[model samples]
Target: MAHRLLLRRFVSVTLRGSSGPVRSRSSALFPSRSSLSWHGTGPPLHHQAVPATARGFCVSHASRVTFNVQNQADFAERVINSKKPVLVDFHAEWCAPCRILGPRLEKMVAKQQGKVIMAKVDIDEHTDLAIEYKVSVVPTVIAVKAGEVVAKFVGVKTEDDLEVFIKKLTCT
Candidate 1:
């Protein structure tokens, strides 16, 4: 019981991030006074109206294995020359189909574990890659093996279809 109490105390202290004295049980259960004041009175000192960066990049989850190709060199090193089969998704931020297919494709690729990997290339950021691959359309998924493109498809595909495609790629 004492250990549990201490554990809870540590959690509360860490979560609250306040150096002041601890609050009563009833008060601690609800929102802290500072949080409520900031919410009611508008932006806090540390709060920002807009993100500092022009665009926010999605960080890969710990369990996920994905790569973002930043340039021609990165694409060559990570995708073309990769030992494992690679799925390159040529996408753009403004494209609706790309947005829809990106996450679905990622989930499908994750199921393959180490057998295959997914690489994302933003067409807007890397025009050279899109032109080199002859990718006129968004969400163009290309399967590369041994530094060569083995399979290519455009538009969104169902999870089932993607699974079938990946299985075929890995089988060979």
Candidate 2:
């Protein structure tokens, strides 16, 4: 009906200057239509890489704020040697407090964008890491900068407290 016509017009306007017969309203929106290859069925397939400018807008920071430590080597490489300050969260799946703190800490860290990153380490899976860090508690958060421990805390903290802790770490 009327909605379908409006959608068709919108598509034509947005896809102007494409390799296909359809003409778009603005060629600047998509500079390289050659990257896209049309097949007989379904949507067009992308055969080549698209330049960043042609890809439209994108976020500069890393989208993921939290990651799990696979092993000792992973912790050494990702957390110990990270350029930005890292908040190492040593936790256990069975611990209720650990479960609560993990998500809150991730939310706070994500708010900081890429200023700080979070490393999740399961105490049960990686006992060696917990022993090395002298973490007897189930939920422990240690802030490391330049391969050194800057600050640490144990037990679950309030959301406001977690935000303050993250802010302090990012500030330094």
Candidate 3:
């Protein structure tokens, strides 16, 4: 019980500063106020929820299927030249929409299994890729296949809309 309380405090502290996933054993024992659920040993905590009033608290989640684009060469090798279609999310750490959309996009992409791969690129960290891709805005999603960009969009989108976009790209 003491450990659970301590874990809860840790989660609270971690989330108080930034909006991201909180992994706590207590989260499984004691459900959070938000929509987080425990599904096995290590599922991405995308569903982890913190209080809305919590300052700097944002929910972030990533799946094992997702990859973070580290640099220009990595992008070229993993996304542009990959066998599967890659959904590239160009975003920034300070972007609120990116925080909201990040986990949601990961969830949606995970449902596709291996049919698609999601790549996250921080605009600040990978400015070159963002500029080359013409990502003037944060939360820009680009679909790349066979070394070419097939479709791209800006801003947040509903899960359904994103699925439709992926379907359109994969169907071709």
Task: Name the best candidate (by TM-score).
Answer: 1
| Model 3, span 54-96: residue lDDT tens | 2343334345569899888888889988999999999999999
lDDT by residue for model 2 (1-172), tens:
8796565555554554356544232223353653253444423433332321223334534347678999999999999999999999999889999989988888888888778999999989999999999999879999999999999999999989988888888888
What are the per-model C-alpha RMSD values against the true structure?
11.2, 11.4, 14.2
Worst 10 residues of 2 by lDDT: 47-56
Top-down lDDT ranking: 1, 3, 2
Candidate whose lDDT is highest: 1
> In order, what lDDT does every prediction score?
0.80, 0.78, 0.79
Comparison by lDDT, 2 against 3, better one: 3
TM-score of candidate 2 against the unseen true structure:
0.64
**Stretches of model 3 off by over 4 angstroms after superposition:** 1-62
Q: By lDDT, is 1 or 3 better?
A: 1
TM-score, every prediction: 0.66, 0.64, 0.64
Q: Quick one: RMSD of model 3?
A: 14.2
